[model samples]
Target: MRTALTIAGSDSGGGAGIQADLKSFASVGVHGTSAITCVTAQNTRSVDSIFPIPVAEIRKQLRAVLGDFDVRAAKTGMLFSAEIVRTVAKELRGTSFPLVVDPVMVATVGARLEQDDFADALGDHLLGLAALATPNRFEAERLSGIRIDDVESMEAAARAILRLGPKAVLVKGGHTKGVLVDVLYDGRRMRRLRGRRYPKTLHGAGCTLAASTAAYLALGRPLLAAVESARRKVAAGFRQSYRAGHGVEIIDSHAVPD
Candidate 1:
């Protein structure tokens, strides 16, 4: 089986972050490995607390997996600080495989994942290193300084983010109403990925999307094809979502192909 690694935080709630990344990798038929950077005391309702493991331990976890496994691809979730980001970026630089970085700034509940100051470094240092950077409307607005209210605005956001130097940028449109349209911009082209919007959110949709993209890239899909494949898979995951908690349904096993 192919191996993929998820370097992310663990959510006891099992909805988003590392839990979601593992489920996504498994659902996609890739053997999943993980490196936990932080642990959160979260339930379906909300995040109550978080414990950050030492950066040394985080590096150890990363070293253990990347050292042994022929890791095909990797995805990163919440690093939560500039030092941790720098550590992860430094370690990943030597790998031949593709890396997908999800700039997880805020949680679903509006909690800040990183301090305000680290936001700039995250964009400057980490994003430019990624094969792909997945950002939501808010994150795009923050990273790209572009507010997206329409398709044109979304394209502008994608372009601005691309300038930060990721090979590509996928701007998720969950923050937009009417339809769940995502805008992906590579230096060569601009494409809008559209899915019929799901009114209720299934937990970990973005994480699932990003993880699936990494898995697909590992399987040799092109960047656009990777995003397209993952986007479709994530859409079905949302459609098949089930109650993992009282608050929201999770993408769960739906990351698997039909």
Candidate 2:
């Protein structure tokens, strides 16, 4: 079976981060491995606190996994500090693995997940190594310094981010006003993926999307095909979402069809 790795934080709520990534990987027929970068005291409602793991420990975990497992692809979520980002980049260097970076800067409930300095490290070291980078509206604004108000601006932001060296960029439009439209730019072609705006917000949708994409890549699917499949999986999970807390629903990764 194919194997994929998630280098991310742990969500106590089991709705995002490593928990969601593992579930998404399993849903897509990939064996999941993980290197927890931090632990968040959070639920569907809010992130109360986050405790970042030491760089040494994070390095050890990455080394252990990359050394043993035949990891075909990997994804990064919440690297909480510049130190962690640099450490992860160092460890991942020289490997030919396809990386899916979900620039997880903030929680769904508006909690900050990383230090401001980490942004620079992410752009400088991590993004250049990524095969694909998935950033939401807010994250794209932060990463590209482009305020996205419409599809045109979103396209500009995707182009700006693509310049940072990621082979492809998916500017997620979930936070947009009306119909959701995710823009994908691979420096050559651009595609817009539109979906109905669900009445209820769902937690872990981004995590599930990125992880499922990594799983597909691990199975040897091409970039665009993997992203398309992952988007469908996320939509299915959204349809199967349930109210796990008082704030928002939680996507059910297990509900994604085979």
Candidate 3:
């Protein structure tokens, strides 16, 4: 079976982070491997605390997986610090497989996930190595310094982010008011992917999208097709989402039909 890896934190709630990534990978029929960067005490409602795994031990996990498995593609989620971000970047440098970078900044419950200086490290070391970078509206605004009020500004932000060296950028418009639209740009052209706005706020939607894309890439699909497939998968997952806790609904990507 083809394999994919997720370099991310472990969410005890099983709603997001490594748990979500692995579930998304399995849904797409890809073997999921992971190198946990941190462990978080979080649930649907809040993130109480986070403990970063030692950089040396994190490297060992990466080496073990990379050395033993034919990892066809990979995605990164919550790297809690600048050092961990740089470490992951260094490990993935020059790798042949596609990488989907989910620039995770804040949790679904409005808690900050990354360190204050993490953004600089991510932009400098990691974004350049991505095959695709998936950032939501707020993250796009932070990364591109452009406020995305409409499709035009979304495209502008994608363009600005593309200049940071990712092969493609998907500026997710999930935070917008009406019907959802995600602007995808691959430098040559821009495509607007539209999806319905579900009533419930689902946790881990972004992680699922990026992870599914990585799994599809591991399955040898092209970048555009993989992204489209991933989006559809997440949409379906949201439809079937259930409350795993008293707070937000968990996006059950595994509940979707393969």
Q: What is the C-alpha lDDT of each candidate?
A: 0.84, 0.93, 0.93
Q: List, in order, the clash count of every candidate structure.
A: 0, 0, 0
lDDT of 2 by residue, 183-224 (tens): 999999999988867777788988999999999999999999
Worst 10 residues of 2 by lDDT: 249-258
**Which window of ten consecutive residues has the lowest lDDT sum in model 3?**
249-258
Write model 3 residue lDDT over 42-93, tens digit each, in one string.
9999999999999999999999999999999999999979999999999999
Residue 26, model 1: lDDT of 80
* Clashing pairs for predicted structure model 3, backbone only: none
Q: Supply candidate 3's per-residue lDDT for 258.
A: 54
Regions of candidate 3 where Cα sits further than 4 Å from its true position: none
Query: At residue 236, what lDDT does model 1 achieve?
Result: 82
Residues 182-234, candidate 1, lDDT per residue (tens digit)?
88888888987888888886668888889999888878788888888898888
lDDT of 3: 0.93
In candidate 3, position 55 carries an lDDT of: 99
